[model samples]
Target: MAEQTPDSLTSSITSRSTTRRAVVGVGLGAVALATAACSTSAGQQEEKQSQSEVTPLVDTRVAFYGKRQAGIDTPAQAHAVFIALDLCEGTNTQALIRLMRVLTADAAKLCAGEPSLVDQEPELAAVAANLTVTFGFGEKIFDIAAPAAKPQWLKPLPAFDEIDRLEDAWNDGDLLLQLCANDRMTLAHAQRTLLKGARPFVTVRWVQDGFLRAHGSEKPGETPRNLFGQVDGTVNPRQEDGTIDRYVWGENVEGLTPWVPGGTSLVIRRIHMNLDTWDLSDRPAREDAVGRKLSNGAPLTGEHEHDKADLEAVNELGFEVIAPYAHIRRAAPEKDIERILRRPYNYDLPVAAASGISQHGDTAGGISQSGLIFCSYQVDPLAQFVPIQRRLATLDMLNTWTVPIGSAVFALPPGCAPGQYIGQQLFEG
Candidate 1:
């Protein structure tokens, strides 16, 4: 996700590099100042200012998985890796900070001179170019934190009656770490590097590999294609310069203390598609539900995916061309249709043989868990994202195939300069 500015490319590159270096140089001293300032009541204003000035370590997005196809055997089950992490007992805050620094450094090294983090997965190579590291924890885990220490904005999501399996996954080992990159090879390389160090504090609960299709050059503003042969990320925020403050960071007024000053909030949902049931739907019905051709992501109203959707256009019978409750129609935000940005990836997991399970079947078949690790970043989750998601969860025809199982939220602080650790604000009073 490269930002285009009015400045010449050469100057832009040069300036950005210089700015990055300067940020790294000042980050550590600033962190110390912030910690000290927060300790004294008289220095509260200075602490706030120092905190505000510190940049985020990475621009992260949240990704979650919903266990819709948990028991079903299918082809998409081979790529899943379950991950679980135990909170470090009496862990030093500085240790966590050092871990982030080490991980970020390793990511930079893996990129081979490129500043952007790379994803090792071929399918995700492009999306991974914009490196984002995301993580979250459940509410019960906070009880384990020391009396004066805790992570910020760490809490349990509103429990949904639809799935009960996630409760154990949450309480047993609550933290989830997601590293998004464009190249699978890069992602693999980075993952191995992080694991070398992360193993001490974080444990791999489940690891699922997935891919999201590139927004077609032929179709603009269309839902993205996934490996599962369905369009995903139809209604997402547009990645653009100057729009970050609005789309990623909510306004800092009205009780909301902007967490990541220049960054945005990432909401990720790992939805499992019931491909068996989805495949059972007739082609016509499937096309009708999505309001487009399944083979290609083009809209019914137009031939190409980028063509403007005609929500009100009528069919030959005078019926609305796009069903009123179609996924795209319901997911689109009414006021600012282009406010949300989605960078989705697909995952296919192979199933394992267990009690009463047959040995001869699709090697990829066991529990097909491939689906979208839906990620969106917005300034206002309640205002910009919730409405759209609520509508889809309640009424979109696709819900029959998708279900929400796991969810978590985190308030990402701004990036820190080199030498400074991530999440510096959590320690500040």
Candidate 2:
């Protein structure tokens, strides 16, 4: 049982297929079988195999909530607690590791119900069970002499104008601590758990917390409508066997290290949607704007949401039934769309009193601050990701519903064994 490295994983995915279509057939079956077989062994072999399969494409159970019915909602809950942290002085990787170790331990304690560090802020503690901690390396994350000389692909997006604000937030302990519980009590408990360890390294940036009504009247899921009330992310990547590596990692880029081995880059954006104005657009106009259904996210050509889109479908007048420039159509054009795995959680907040006044109560009344916490994982953020986002940012009709406010790119190093912490590669370098 050899310990897997990023290089080995990248080699495995690249050596298998040349095109995205090839990812689905025999190649995927072979990988799945191989992974299953490797899982049989008792030791390192099993662990390594498991690591190889942990791609972002897998179904990650996600629940979202907002602060309208604080004591009463199910499925999803929400809170915005701004956090800030001071950077460790030197290039002491051990210090950073220690910091994370302590942080994780506190996180566990909070979730498990120790003394309850966040008891004072009951809402924060209630949301701990639904929490996930991730780390990123800034452009300066790697010290000089690190392997491959800080891959050019690792830099932040050119469109991210708020680099300073983002850095400040991260350094200031910026983290989204989510609480996934069915009842208000459970949500409150989770929040208490998270706030315990989070308090030392992070401080509240701002606190606006509450719960969202369950996804539907019957079951929990994404909001029927996006922030704009139009269904979004309907055409997201499906959770299949071998598709993770392709969607998470890039195709044929060379020299770049795979931080998380089989895992890919998770790009998170806080996209603000103009629900007030978006809700005013008529159905036909809205459909024309996005070239898809306002309900199920189906393409304008009547293709099922999950079907391979038919860009060629056109009306009798030769007008493309699905607008040629529609978000989905352009995002995944008939011939050349690169797909990425999306795991988004919805967020809704109450608008500030001042901000809420402008809408004259026409909005969700409470200044409904709802948007998609857009998280996508890809192998090469630079290649597969940036292009699509660039397109969306520049010309997608849905941009009318969304505007990216905060952004950060983190290189997720592979998951480490029990005694190990993340970012072991930085130490080796």
Candidate 3:
């Protein structure tokens, strides 16, 4: 079993290009030190420090190391790329461990706004841009590593009947990494660097890129709208006061393997929105499909978006104000543990849409492609996400315009403390 605590994680700096280490060590070491000092004292001076003193090019940065992964609960950044990798032939437990140690070490440095100890272009690493890199293990990761430590829900989706088309290219993998940031260059650099580290042990299986409203583009608390123009994530679980603790984090779940304490499960579905055909539907039809208003995202049965949808309330015609087949009605949790925290991203494939690629294929170049990378985090996929998905798959009217082409579920561990690598508990157990 990997020990509960490791002594060497802090030392896992990517060997930054040794030739440049002399110069970079002095430069980046100061930046990392200042960043750490700021973390220790949460005061006004720290909060209101001169803009000139901080790295001018990148102002916002989410701490890379914490109790929980940053990207899951952190407000969605402007850009993201989700990549999955298949384990190379002959990889075993030891190889997996070595690869993870290197990847984890590099991820930590990049997350903290420092170049990998071996970073070639140290300048590019300076733009923190709220960069966050989160890792998840696929079901196959367990088969090769500690099979006994595998979580029950860490597998591919079951036979989903509503799916119009599914492709192997986007299906399953041995690993998953989500790279997010506010700046495109920073995001691109991080992706390239991480993939290079992973090249020896795994091959790229799929890459799905997504984005939300740019930071400051919308009001601070506003929910982002999807390509369908509906305010998505209208009913996400609250992160404060332990609501997220209850639904999204997995420390207290009963009967869980030791590997998953303080960890969670993730679902990533690439739902292709048929904009060409959706444009044919009228405003009322769209509203009926989602059970929310297009203008302000209010529930059909209520005036404001956050107003509870009166599922039982009747219209003058004696019909329920919220239609029985509406997305909201079907998606709302009917019992405890049915709710999941949704953190989805809107995806509009520039080249595919502009060039007329077929949308059914499981790739970015698929024709007429524009949709959502529908992501949700939950303590248990079976208890929280599956039932809701089944309801939507069977009868929701919105299914007419959306097709799930790619789907995956990953087991995400909690953040590592300074000295430990992620998933240390799993290996130790």
Candidate 4:
């Protein structure tokens, strides 16, 4: 069999009379063609054909260069860590430039399955494992570059009523590096290699880590289920949807905010979840809290996970079926433009007995330090994220079991081209 072009594949599929949809990836010259059929024989034939061409995990690699950062739009990997760092006492523009250049070169090689220039264990880079290294700027970065022109929104998030206690250790930083990969070893090597290069110029501020089911654990496209056992990231924008221009890139005009074209804003919140108390709630109560079923994540008013939530539905008593303060109900946007892309991961940490912590902390009190690194990306968080969060802060029922403990924001720079550093435009544009 010869390699089929997208057009040729669509034409061939029509001959078989099976339904198919093609999603073209920009600049990729490839179409993800999905086929469906009513006949068992046809389905089985397609399944067997797919099994022969399954992509090996280690063989998969994501390019470090593009119009947008790779990890932002790319499918979430199995393992990830978000690291925050602060500049050394005397770090200057020249030192910052050198740091960025080294990271760029190291990331290029590491992402392409080659050892870092100073890699002690070259074999560790053997399995690139779809690894990606994304860089982000905090307010301090701009202060170092040019204090006069920093974006107005590049400041600390305003205090929210829902926030019980925000820990400074995990709250803010001057620089951010989001490292993701299918394998932890591969991710660790990449992180160490880059951090080693930036060590003299910066210090570790905070490290928030999380993960999902590994590759091959389930269907590739299935949304990951969080520790709460609810399906996560169901409504994210597809990378090839072409809607990223409206939702994630501000203005879509070059140098709109200091070479910020294709760049997006990131919100990172450490939401502590009280699972012990959550476990006390029965199945229906848990489902009711989230406005979705515990089994398949379908809305209470619908039968499928993707079914439109019937917010207006009521029962015999005339009470809202989705609940007045259900998380989904409160978080749902009334207008089209109010939506933001959510990319979150579950995090768990044991409370040390040395700290004299207890287990049954309850709702208003703190949990044993386990939570979700609730992260999102938007063109302007001021418009897209703040409003919905403000609403949730007031009366969302899920807030009883979850508390915001850490909060920070970063400016995700546009992607780099070959031989260009991640934030090259910020200095040169």
User: Is 1 or 3 the stronger prediction by TM-score?
Assistant: 3
Give me the runs in candidate 3 sitting further than 4 Å from their true place: 1-57, 251-259, 351-367
Name the candidate that leads on lDDT.
4
Each model's lDDT = 0.47, 0.47, 0.75, 0.75
Across residues 1-429, which tens digit of lDDT does each residue of candidate 4 receive?
A: 222221232233333322111111221222123333334444555555544444555666787777777777666778889999999988777888999999889988888888988899999997887788988899988888766646677877778965457878789899999988888889889989989988989999999988888754555556788888888777665545655556767543232232267788888988888776777788888888889987887899999888999999999999999999898998888666566778788887765542433244342233456678888887767777887888888878788678888899998888888878887777665
> Which scores higher on TM-score, 2 or 4?
4
- Per-residue lDDT over 1-429 for candidate 3, one digit per residue giving the tens place of the 0 to 100 score: 111111121122112223233343455545556766664453333334422232232655677777777678776777999999999999887787777777888888776678987788878888777788888999877887688878777777676776547777778677889988878899888998888888898999999999988753454356889888889887887754566777888544453222455678889988888876677789999998888899999998888988988888888999877788999999988776787889888888665235443332233443456888989998888878898998888888888778888889998888877767776666655
lDDT of 1 at 264: 42
Clashes (candidate 3): 14
Native-to-model Cα distance after best TM-score fit, residue 22 in candidate 3, in Å: 47
Task: Give me candidate 2's TM-score against the actual structure.
Answer: 0.63
What TM-score would every model get versus the actual structure? Answer: 0.62, 0.63, 0.82, 0.83
290, model 2: CA deviation in Å?
Answer: 1.9
Question: 91-176, model 1: which lDDT tens digit per residue?
Answer: 55455656556654544343332323433433332222323344433333334333233334444434444331242432324444
Please identify which of the two predictions, 3 or 4, would achieve the higher TM-score against the true structure.
Answer: 4
Question: Which residue segments of model 2 deviate by more than 4 Å?
Answer: 1-91, 107-131, 140-151, 160-195, 198-225, 249-257, 333-337, 354-368
